[model samples]
Target: MTGDHAARPGMAAPRLALAGWVLFDWAAQPFFSLVQTFGYAPYFVRVMVGDPVAGQAYWGYGTAVAALLIAVLSPTLGAIVDQMGRRKLWIGATGAIYALCCVLLWFCRPGEPGAIVMALAAVCVAAVAIEIAVMVNNAMLPGLVDRSHVGRLSGLGAALGNVGGVVATLLVLTLFVANPGTGKTLLGIAPILGLDGAHQEGARAIGPFSALWFGCFILPLLLFTPDARPIRTGTPTIRAGLSALRASLRELPRHPALLRFLIANMIYTDGLVALFAMGGIFASSILGWTAIQVGLFGMLVTTAGIAGALAGGSLVDRIGARAVVLLTLGLLMAALAGTLSLGPDHVGPWAVAPPRPDRVLFDSAAERVYLAIGTLIGLCSGALLASTRIVLIGLAPPDRLTQFFGLFALSGRVTAFLGPLSVAVATQLMASQRAGIAVLMVFFAVGMALLATVKTR
Candidate 1:
C-alpha cells in the first residue's frame, strides 16, 4: 500500500485504458443531462405527468433517494475495492448495472401507474452503481502516470466526458427531439428513419439510447485495462477494507487539511449539483422552450464544459488547487446571481419583450442571452469539479485511498439532500422557481469561505 504500489510494473496497460474510463462519464452524462435534468424530467412533469409541482416534488425525492443510497454504500464499497485491489472488476460490474437501469428507463411510459416511482428506482440504482464505478476508476489515478501528470490526466477525462455529452446531445436532437413547428429535427429529416413526434416517442427513446451508449463505449476498458496483482487467495479483502475504514476515521484528525477540503467540497458540490439539475427545468418552465431548445442549450453547455475542464486542469498545474477552486467558485457565485436575476423577457432586472420560441437556434435575443449565461456556469462547474478531484488525490493517504475517498463520497451524499430539499421548499414558498434557484448561492458562498482556510500543501 505504499505510494510505490501505484507504480508497479503492470500499471502501464491500464493507463492506456483511459479511453474506456473517460468514455464512461461520456456515456453516463446524457442520462443526467437529457433524461434526468432537461428533457425527460420536465417532459414527465409538464407533458406526461401533467403537473409541474408534482413533477418537481417527485424529481426532488428521486434525487434525494439516489444520493442517500450512494452515501451509505460508497464508503464500504470503496474500502472493499481498495482491499481487494481489483478496481477494474468493480468498474465493469457497476457499469453493467448502470447500463441496465438506463435501458429500463424506456419502460417508464407516460400516464402509466407508478411510472414515476419505477423511473426513480432505476435512477437510484444507477446512481449508486455509477458512484462505485467512479471511485474504482479514480483509484487507478495515482498508478496511471507520474504525479506531474495527474491534474492533466484528470482534466482530460472530464474534457472527454463533456465531448461525449455534446455528441450524445447532438444525436438525440437529430434523431428524436424536434421543432414543434416543422415537426422536424436539426437535420431537417424526419427524426432518423421515420421516428416521428407521434406519442412523444422521440422523448421516450432517450432511456434506451443512454443505455446503449454506455454499453458500447465501455468495452475498450474492459478489454484493455490492467488488473492489480492479486494478493494471497485466503485473505478477505472485504474484511480488511472494513478494518481500514475504522482506522482511517480514527486517524482523520491527523489529516486536518484533507478533512477541511472534504467539508468544503461537500457544500460546494451540493450546490453545483442543484444548479445543473434544476437549470433545464427552470429554463423550460420560464422560457417556454421545447425539447429542441433544451437540447441546443445542453450542447452549448457541453462544449463550454470541455473547454473549462481543460483550462481548469492547466490552471491547477500552474497556480495550484486552492487558486483554481476559489477562482472558479467566485465565478460560480457571480453566474448564479446573474442567472437568477434575469427573466426570459428581462436582462439584469429590466423587462423586455420575450423572444419567440418558434425561431431557429439563437434566433431570439433572449435565447442568446440565456445560452451565454448557461455557458459561463457550465465552464466554471467543469473546471471546479475536475480541479477538486485533483485536490482529493493530493490529500489522500497513499495506502488507504478507498477509505478516504469513501469519506469524500459520504460528504457529497450526506448533505446532498439540503440543496434539493431547499429547492423544493423554496419553489412552494415563494411561488417561483427562481426563488428556489436563488437558494443555491448560499451553499457556494459558504463553501468558498470554508475552502479558503484549507492548506493543500
Candidate 2:
C-alpha cells in the first residue's frame, strides 16, 4: 500500500528486495530464450510452416505487429502508471496476461485448423505483455537502489536472465524436446510427458513450460519488492496521466541529451531484437539444424551472455556505462559481419569445409566458425543490453522515472517494427535470408553514430 519501507535515495535496499527484483529478469527470460530465439521459432519455421522463407516472413510480420503494439501502448501506459504510482500491480496484471498467452501457445498444432494464426496471435500478445511488464519493472530499479549500485544491479539482472535462459533451454532439450532421427531426448530417453516428437508436441510444450516457470519465479517480487503508493485513482488518474503525457512529449525536445540517448537506444535495440528473432531461423534454414542443435547453440550463446553481463556490469561502474556501450556495440557489429559471412560450405567467397555426408553435430569448419561468431554476438548483446539500461537510468530525471521508462519502451519499439518488417520484405523479395538480416547492420551503425552525441554523467 505504501512505499515507506522501500529503499530511499542514498540508502541500500534490503538484500531480499534486491534479489526479488533481479529474479524478475530470471522469470521472464525463458520465453525469450526458448520460445522466441531457440526452440519454438525454429520448430515453427522448419516443421510447422514447412518452408523456411515463408515461415521467416510470417514470423517477421508477427514480430512487427507485436512491436507496433508495444510502441503505441508502452509510453501511454507508463505515464498512467506514474500517475497511479503502484508499479507492482501493473507488473502483476501484465505478467498474468503474458503467462496466459504463453499457455495458449500449447494449442498451436501443425495441420490443425487455424493453427498458424493461433500461434502468431499468442506470440504477439505474449510479447506485448512481457515487454510492458519489463518496462514497469525497469522503472522500479531507480527506487530499489541508490545511484551507485544501479549499473551493478542492471548487470546482475541481465546475467541472471541469461542464466535462466540457459537453464530453461537445457531443460527443454533434455526433458521435453526429442531428436527426430532417434526420437529421443538429449538425455537419450523418451520425452517425460509422453510428448509426441513425431508430431512436434515436445517443441510446442515450450509455451506451457515457460508459463509455469514465469508463474513460479515471479512470486518473490510480488511478495517482497516494495511498491510506491497510489497518488490518484479511477477517471481522475486517467485524465491527469493523459495530460502529463502530453506535457512530457512537448518538453521532451528541451532535454536534448535524453532525447538523443532514446533515439540511439531505439535504433540499436531494434537491431538486437531482429537479430534474436532471426538468428534461430537462420541456423535452422542455412545449416540444416534440428531442435537439438539449435538448443545447444542457445545454451552456448546464453552462457556467453551470462559472462558478458557480469563483466559489463562491473566495467560500467569503473569505465562508465557509455564506454561499455560503445565497446559492446563495436563488438556486436563485428560479430554480425562474421555471422553474415558464414555459409554451410564456406566462409565468405572461399568454398571450404564442404558438407560431409557423415557429419556429426556442427562438424564443418564453417559451422564451428559460426558457433564462435554466435558466442561473440551473445556476449556483446548481453553487455549492450545492460549498458543501455544503465545509460537510460543515468540520464532520466528522478521524478519522472516511470514516464521516461515508458518513453524508453516507446523509443525501442517505435522503429522496432521496421527492423523485422524490413527483414521480412527483403527476404520475401530477394528470396535470401542473408539479405534480410543484413539490414540490421544499418541500425547498429546509425545507432552508434547517434549515441556518440549523448552526454552522460
- Count of steric clashes across candidates, in order: 0, 0
Per-residue CA lDDT of candidate 2, range 100-139, in tens? 9999988888888888989989999999999999988988
Q: Name the runs in model 2 displaced over 4 angstroms.
A: 1-15, 313-324, 354-358, 389-406, 453-457
Flag regions of model 1 displaced more than 4 Å. Answer: 1-7, 14-18, 142-152, 229-236, 317-320, 389-410
Residue 144 deviation, candidate 2, in Å?
A: 3.5
TM-score of each: 0.88, 0.91
* Local distance difference test, each candidate: 0.75, 0.86
* Alpha carbon lDDT at 303, candidate 2: 88
What would the per-residue lDDT of candidate 1 be over residues 305-327, giving only the tens digit for each residue?
77787788889989997889999
